[model samples]
Target: MTRPRATVVSLNQRIRDDIEARIRSGEWPPGHRIPSEHELMARYGCSRMTVNKVLSMLAAHGVIERRRRAGSFVARPHPHIESVALDIADIPLEVTQRGHDYRFQLLSRRKRRPRRGHGPEMQVAGDGSLLVLQSLHLSDSAPFALEERVIGLAAVPQAQQQPFDRIAPGSWLLQHVPWTRAVHRISAVNADAEQARRLQVEAGTACLVIERQTWRGEQPITYVRQMFLGEAYDLVARFAPGRPARRD
Candidate 1:
């Protein structure tokens, strides 16, 4: 029999959304434990069953996690945020959700200033900053793409804590931090010696290049060049048949 005049389902959804928002906002990171059922029940004035339903749903969706006796907690290590498009903004959460054999390698990192010769456009930055991070994105242990990224140390100071071996550069950036704005440019080019060798493809192979300029409010936050082995990937874009397209 159903209970009458109770805020069970509604409360479940409310708490669920709250937890999801926290994760998206980077308050709750990967592999982090979520509140226990008892805590959630008390927090929301709901029953244990209500909290259990919400948590079960989240686990099914690959968001938070649940353990037998350890209780529920946030998932702080799931690598989500790569498979999504550049424009929708949040990418890390998506990458982590995709249960694929993925890996990353850090090639280089440097603290430097943008070259003056590159002109005022590239030279401009908040706090006279730039942290150059070079990395390689991989799937199933095979090199997939090359990343050349410039980070604004002011908005995200811990840019150095990124572990290239465990997180894709894109996933790492989105999950651990937040951005105000970003400009992504995708193009194609023929692979050079270094690119070809790393990608295990023949020289002159066509490759897709993705360039991004990110911002924090009005201040630019990052500039990134992501090069992909084009022949192996197909970038897909989906939309409603009637939704108006957004201008870049």
Candidate 2:
């Protein structure tokens, strides 16, 4: 057991960042096989063990996939939706506590330049990158909510690395990022054909759409719309006379 040298520690992070930058920049597209461990060891002038550790971390984070004797490749991205609670709570836990089996499916994900109309809502100007995700949530096999989200790449660059199939984007951000303020808008809307299909309800059915935008200080973190089936979900809040409720 030997400790990593100071130079080795620095090199490890540099190597990892370089590889990640290449992947995010599309230089190493999804399913692209990265250079072999031996090649990387030669290129970085580091030991095989250091390269292995770096690759392992990336693989564990779903950023890359490594096969036995086959080498590693960038993973294709998965769609994921982020949600916010005016009073933050674990959504899966909330559903389970209510005695329903919770499940969700990814619908779509895209990273592209925002449309001209999206500028004002996201507080951004010009053509900047936006990460969008759509998903459907179910309770006990019944459609519950449809989530659509747009995240600003400038504020959270790591958003590009997340494939939210296993973890909801909202939950992940809650755990990793800190936010200073959030604004919530609740409204009633009729389910359109697409929303109806996703919710397993007929078109024109009533729904509650909860739109939330959260920021870290002044930089926007994400904006999400959660459309819940009118009959399937409820929004609850508790308050005291003078004190504000807890937020996380």
Candidate 3:
């Protein structure tokens, strides 16, 4: 009896799986060029379209990088930076994933009523009090980022009782609170004296800052500003065109 041949979809998957396996097993390290599409087509006995689709998928997933004329290569790793898409990340987890020890230090904590000069995020508290926190995130005993945050007591009353000494406020809030919407603002700024001292960088060094505010419906939950040494961080966003609908 003769065995049945694999379908086109299976062939594409098999080619993709083989390439990924080689890269993962260290057989094909970062910057190692992958075989050309023609070679893959011949090796798999598949069409150039099928091979191209597999390569496109790999590039989309960051498993490989394609050059205009040099063909594809295993993508180099980014170990110190964190990437996110439409979600908040726990800083501690980000550090650990980069193969470093993570530590959080709470620099200060204060409870006070919102005042006129306190900033717009504070106004969200209305008549309620605010829990303000400043902290440091360290990776392998080196300064990673500095965080300043304010939690609205009216929205999260439980924040008042939490010490926030052992855990960073952002991580704590993500675990305990439910936020429906969030806005992020990214900018570059020269580090001031206080910021430079805390981050252990030279004064006037360029830094990347991310400011975010989250809300649950009409109730504001929290607002935070995080600063990092520019070379130590990166922000990445990926997009692809939507597929056309199929017609029956």
Best model number under lDDT: 3
Better model by TM-score, 1 or 2?
A: 2
Runs of candidate 3 exceeding 4 Å displacement: 1-86, 117-119, 241-248
Candidate that scores best on TM-score: 2
User: What lDDT does candidate 3 reach at residue 108?
Assistant: 93
Candidates' RMSD to native: 14.1, 13.7, 17.7
TM-score of 1: 0.57
Give lDDT tens digits, candidate 2, residues 1-248: 56658677678768877887787677999899999999999999888999999998677656678999999998764433232345755566667888999887889999877666664344621235788889877788887778987888776666787898987777777765555467788999999998888888899999999887776534677888899878767777655666455542
TM-score of each: 0.57, 0.63, 0.62
Descending-lDDT candidate ranking: 3, 2, 1
For model 2, name the residue pairs that clash.
none
Instruction: List candidate 1 stretches off by more than 4 Å.
Output: 1-85, 88-99, 119-124, 161-165, 241-248
Whole-model lDDT, model 3: 0.80
Q: Which of the predicted structures, 1 or 3, would earn the higher TM-score when compared with the native?
A: 3
TM-score of 3: 0.62
Which lDDT tens digits does candidate 3 get at residues 113-148? 776776656655767888889999999999999998
RMSD of 1: 14.1
